[model samples]
Target: MAKQTIQLQLSGMSCAGCAKSIEKALGGVQGVTTVNVNFANEVAAVEGDKLNSEQLVKAVKDAGYDASVIDHQQPEDDSRERAQQIQFYKFLAAAILSLPLLYTMVGHFSWTENIYVPAWLMNPWVQMALATPVQFIIGWQFYRGSYTALRGGAANMDVLVALGTSAAYFYSVYLAASLGDHAAHQGLYFETSAVLITLILLGKWFEARAKGRSSAAIKQLLNLQPKQAVRERQNGETETVDVAKLQVGDIIHIKPGQQIPADSTVVSGSSAVDESMLTGESVPVDKHEGDDLTGATLNKNGFLKAKVRKLGRDSALAQIVKVVEQAQNSKAPIQRLADRVSAIFVPVVLLIAVVTFLVWAFWLDAGNYGKALEAFVAVLVIACPCALGLATPTSIMAGSGRAAQMGVLFKQSDVLEIAHTITTVVLDKTGTITEGKPKLTDLEIDLKGVNGVTEAQLKQAVKATEQQSEHPLAQAVVQGIEVEALEQINDFNAHEGRGVSAKVTLSEQSHILRIGNIRLMREHDIESDAWSKRKDELEQQGKTAMLISWDNQAVGIIAVADTVRDNANAAISKLQQRGLKVVMLTGDNQRTATAIAKQVGIEYVFAEVLPEHKADKVKELQQQGERVAMVGDGINDAPALATAEVGIAMGTGTDVALETADIALMRADLNSIHDALFVSKKTVRNIRQNLFWAFAYNTLGIPVAAAGLLAPWLAGGAMALSSVSVVLNALRLQRLSLNHRD
Candidate 1:
């Protein structure tokens, strides 16, 4: 059976229990194999065979929530912004009405000395008149949410709020009627109920605003896509069209200082393109014919025409956006504890409140029903489950969002949380530590044979043979040779893992020319002592020397070396300084790998390891009790990347690497590896801080409220502060910096 994944936007999830309810509801649907609902980001991901999105939506609705299928082609809806606005207006109106009731209660305090209280304000009916609207009108959402959760056979933060405030409001009404004509405002607690709702609404408004800021990274990425493109018609005329209309093979024109409309290859013209938006490299890269151009990058100082290679969801920008959204929506393993506790937190709090009321009413203050009412209301108002539910997910959202802005993409929240514990980083030699592109760095020619073969003729012959090979080192040899004219070669053949040989018709005679490693020359029975010494010297200097032989005699040696990336040494030093063991894994021979490793300050080396054996090396590290992180160009390093505790892929790698790896570094710079770890540590630290406050707030507040020392109004204010403080603390991750100096 074929499987499909559907993502939906969710609404009305006030706590982790709501997320669990949606997950459970979707899990019960036919053809639904798996469901994950994230309360922090308000998203649900469902995977199943023969699944209907409508059925999933109906399931969520049946479970007392709202959901809609997300269309990635269109911009994300403004549901969150609208919700925030509505919350702000609710807070505003509640605050406006709450002020008069608050002032009336304050008028009874001796601290308001010399402030004359109006006789009408002191009337119990007047206090009830001001507080009634604040209780039912402005606070109606709590009652609605409470009813929803009750019908679903669950409870949430809303249930607690509604129960606590209604208890005080109704008890105060009973007292007012019992006193009849002598009714006084002194014993009435209407102010507590009214002020509590207003304060909770204020906290909700702040949380909504903070949540909006936490997702700003996705908004910025969505804005990068240009709305229109200049398409070149087949008739040699250009037309301005929507970017969505351009299909594969359609030619598009990009002028200087314009954004490339889509991911394409430059078919003509040369220019410098700024890829900072995609790769976070500030410098503009020079682009020539046949060079790949990414969408949303700016073309600087030249005009270019290109054929679209990818559009819509296939584009690099779209993929980044999708990856980020998934990361934000995913829940880390560390969050499981919080989720489990939150699922039972409200029920536990309600039971505790009941126990508190029973102890005060029947035992401690026997028959003193007013004191019992006060203890019950205070206990319910002070226990905030929302803080516990928001602790981990809010931090993950802010951390993942911030990481994306720095050109690092955490594909999963678990990876973001786990990266902090990686004790060993196994780095791939090519692409991870050094530039993957090899260039000819040195050339040594032997001319003492007196065979009438000049250095120029030998170089031309090597280039002719190397030109036919598709290997990077072979291309380097072809590029390094600068002969104005070359001889025509015939019968070219490539030997895998050894070299290439061809029969070149030079000087009107056929001569076999071979260019490859020493093993290839040895196989051909070509031997030269001088070339052997030169090859050793180049190899020791971290270069791969290809032996060039004419007929059966060694003629010259061409050395190719991959340049080390800038800041590789500094990045390695930083990792080592942090007490992480660094090792280099590569397919190159021991001598070359050791030389490159030495240059980059890496002590441990795993050389001559094939792509398939890379994972074995990682397993070997794990056996030694080390938590390993594998960093590589995600393509060839898939096995090792998958085996390690954390897999970090370079964004410059292939699609397979990006899809397989847990973390993607947009910049090729090795410094990003260190930065990723830095951010991970900071994010985890922030999560711990949020959890501590969440736990401490309830541990301290619940007892004080139950002991009858805390007033219901004060308890409500403390509860609101607890929820808002957790959100504020999580937002601190957005400002996390990896600004350590080298």
Candidate 2:
């Protein structure tokens, strides 16, 4: 079956159990293959064959939740803000109504006996009147949720809240009617029901507010795209239009401080564009004519008119948003364990409450119904599975979202979870540890002490041979030479892990030219004793040295040195400080690799590793019990990257590396590795904290409530506070600064 993925916006989920119920319901659908419901994000992703949107929505509704198909083609809506506002208003009204109930109940105590109070307000019937509206009207959501859960053969936080408040409310009504004339003076719980509901509502409002803040990163990303753009008309007139209206090949004018409306090539002007949003580099990059510009980056200075290359959803900003949203919605491995626990949590809690009530009523108290009823209500209210459900998803959402803001992208949830466990980080020296660009630092020519051929002629021959190869060193030699016309090279050959060779015809005379390392020279039987000394000198200086042999004789040496990145040493030192073993792996010779490693503070260096053997090296590290994270930027590194426990790709690297990597650092900055690890550790820690609170509350509070130490109303308040506390804790990840500045 050809499967398609669809994301559904969900509502009416009260706890982790609610998400589980929705998942089960959707999984039961005929065409559904897989379903993942993220309670924190309130979004469900489903993959299936010939899936019907209506059928999916019906299944969710049947499971007692509301679901709607999300149209990803449109800009994200602020419906969550509206939901938060409604929840806030409900809380405000509950708070106002609860005041009188508190005063009426507390005022009768000895601590406030001196305060004058109306006798009518003190009456049990009058108190019931004030609480009835609060319990039935303002708190209707709980009852509706509980009923839905019951109909779906499940239970959630709503079941707990509804059961607890109803017991108190109905128990008070029974007391008032049975006691008759003595009801005014007897103990009543009319205010208990009202106060509990109000407090819970207030906590929910706070939680909703905190959840909004957790997703603020996404909103900020969406806001980066300008709504309108000024398009330069063919007649020299400018027309303002929506960004969506601009198509490929359309010319748009960008001014200083204005966001580039579309991904385009600078065809006319030059300026500095701040790509910190995408690349995480704080420095603004200089742009000139013919340079590629990404959408949503700010034009810091000068004016530019460019032709749009990618528009609307195809733009880089839109793709980043989509990737981040998918990551947030995706489930991490830890979350799967939490979901497994939550699927059975509510039923177990219900059974516990039943057993607690039975023991108190029949065994302990021998029909002390009041004490038994209190324990039952307390047990039900204090047990909240919502906190457990929220532990991983919320933190993942916030962490991944914040990472995106910092220009690091975790393409999948597993990456964020796995990055924290990397024990060793193996860095590729060429593009990863040092700047990938290598210049032709030195070029020497030897005509065997037989003068007549100038150095310029030798350079032309080298450049012609280098042009046939795509290696970085070859490009450096080709660029460094000053040749107007290159003679045709026939029988060109490229040796894997060696270099290039070809037959050049200059002045109607043909000679074989081989440009490569010493190994290639030895295989060709070219004598290079003098050139070998020069190569060793260059290699000791951290420069790659290659020999050019012509017709079975060594001619000269070509050396190129790649500059180390500015933050290479600092990043490596930081990783080592964090207790991670850092190793440098490259194809450079031992001398050159050692020199570069020493400059970058790398303790371990593996040189002369061929492309195909890279994966084997990673395996060898794994055999030593090291959880290796391979960092590379070339297509040849793809196998090693896939073999490692974690693969980090530089954003400016090749597409193959990015596609294979688990983590993509948008810029060449090496510090992002430390930052990503830091964020991952923090996020995982936050999840653990949330889980502790969730599990701890139930583990401790259930027993205390069952022992009658906690009143049902107080248990209700604690339950609300427990869920709210977990959400607020997860929200802390949103403010986590990866820069680690004191």
Candidate 3:
């Protein structure tokens, strides 16, 4: 049975340990095959054989987190924004309440003692009054989180905060209760707990703001979708309607500078359309009658009446957005180590905090209970699992989002991790390295001694016969045949890779017409004879030369060539510079394949290999220890694409090829190949840098805090900074650019 994937938005995840705890709970559910809970995005992607979304959500709630099913088609209702706003208000309240405690704190320190403190601020009643609300009210979230965590048989950052702050707050409350003792005011540590909460709230507020910018790419894409379109009615009138109301068969009118409403075909008029937002190609593409128009592309000039081919999720833009969203939610393989560490992060920190108090109070300091409490609080607040959790997902989100902006979409986080290791790049010749469209370039005719036949009649038979074949070269021949009338064809047959043949009646007589290579002519007991030399000459020029025959006699030869992309050479040069071996794969004959390969600076070529054998070649290279990345844009390329280590499909490719690919390049040229690989390498590097620092911050920090080197408030602030810094480093990927020559 195929697995079903479900996404859930989670709440109450204060740290990475919370994310891991929820993952374990969901995994215990029967039929759950895979679970990936992203701390940065606050989303859980679960794949199961027969999953119930409600059941999954219940499991999360049981693990101390709240969850609800996510809807892909609907726009987000901005619940995250509302949550951030609520946190901001809480932070403001905490800061305001903690200010008086901070003011009195200066009196405790010797260096700031000269600064006057209000005599009333030192009263025990005043100290308890200022710290109570900040402790129990503004900091209630930590208490609730701690209760839920312990009840669920797990621990998180909340447990530490609640434990440490409550110890200081309740201890100070005991000192305040003894109003008869005047020394109680000096013993009160209320400022420590209150000030710690204030710093933590400030840090969380900054971290939330940075995390918001990491997912900005998806928002930019969502904003690109036009909400409204001009629909043409049957009564010859145009009416503006919501894009959601459009259907597959609807007729839409596109005025100058208006966005195309849906994936449609232009039935009337011509214009230049800017598809830069989708393809990352800055130049405007010319669109004429019968050309396909993608939705969300700007029509630069002229009015067009188009018939919609696809709408909603079936459209190209929606699919691109879906790819990006799925990639951003995926977890990289390196995240497993982080998850394992986070599962026990809080418990380990809690143990260390207890050890610090024992060592400082009983062993080193002997009688100093106050100094031991400070060390214990510092140890509890300094160790952060949030940084480790945000490290990988934040980088993946930013990198994939930036890749999509450059017209490259990684289908999953695993692809982003693996694409940088590709050693061999196999490019399809016909449509990948060269423009998929082949225009008619040269056509020559020699009617031989076939008597009473005009060149036009023979050409008419050629056009009618070639029109039935879907081969690019055959189409080129058909378009080049400028005859006003076409001859009727009978018994037309297409030979895969060789050529096409048919029976045509011309000049009131029936004749056999064939168009193919010299081998096809020889198979039929006919030879190109005089045209053989010309065929070799055309093949030498990277053009496919076809031998046309009538009644077993050579009549003419037509040469069609596919132009190489303008940046093909530059892209190949860049790849070779990076130590990647570039190879060309094509069904075209050796001579033509070699010619095209030479033009693109590729030293290796797989010529005359049929479509079925494409996958075999990729496997053979893989067996030879080559990590292959197959790039193509046709139905024949799908098998090979799926066979390679990384399948890169051009956005202009067929649906089957694109769906089979791991990375989809929106641009129609090979320059995106360089861009995609560049982005992958840079993103992986960024992830590594983030992971290193996140680990180092915790590893080096916990010891210092336990040794009493950091103040409790400073420790709380540092913990928050660690997570924010990792996310900020990941956000730098959004600004990465390879400066493509194209």
| Candidate 2 least-lDDT 10 residues | 650-659
Model 1: pairs clashing at backbone N, Cα or C within 3 Å: none
lDDT, residue 484, model 3:
53
> In model 1, where is the ten-residue run with the lowest total lDDT?
651-660
**Which regions in candidate 2 have their CA more than 4 angstroms from the true location?**
1-4, 29-34, 47-55, 71-73, 93-100, 107-137, 176-184, 363-368, 445-470, 485-494, 501-514, 519-530, 549-556, 653-657, 738-742
List, residue by residue over 1-742, the lDDT tens digit for candidate 1. 6778789889887777778878888999898887878777788988889889999999989887899998868866888889889888988888887787677666556888467767676677777887788789888888877887888788888899899989888887887888843555446777778888998888887877876777677788888888899999879999999998899999999999899999999999999999877765678999999999999999999999998998988888888888888788888888888888887888999999999999999999998777888889888888867788788888888998888777788998888898989999999987778787898898887767646467777777778778888766777777887884356788998875567999877668788888876667778788866677777888899997777788888777788899998889988998999999999998776789899998989999998776788999999999999999999878778889999999989765214128668999987877788878987898899888988888888888889889999988888788777777888888888886657435
Per lDDT, the best of the predicted structures is 3
- lDDT of each structure? 0.83, 0.83, 0.85
The C-alpha local distance difference test score for the whole of candidate 3 amounts to 0.85
For model 2, what is the error of residue 449's alpha carbon versus the real structure, in angstroms, after optimal superposition? 12
| lDDT (10s digit) by residue, model 3, range 1-742 | 8878898988888888777688889999889998888888888989888899889999998877789888756866588788788889988988888888788878777899899988788887787888889899989989988888788788888899889888888878776775434744446778889988888887777878888889888888777878899888889898999988888888999999898878899899999999887877788999899999988889998899999998777888878877887888888887778878888888899999999999999998987877889899988888867788899999999999998888888999989988999999999998788887787777888876887567988888888898898877778877877885464789999877678899887667777888888778989999667887888888999998888889898989888999998889988898998899999999888899999999989999998887889999999999999999999873668899999999998766214126788999888878888888888898899999998998899899999998889988888889888888999999999997647443
Question: How do the residues 347-369 of candidate 2 rate in per-residue lDDT, one tens digit apiece?
Answer: 88888988998999999997777
Clashing pairs in 3: none
Better model by TM-score: candidate 1 vs candidate 3: 3
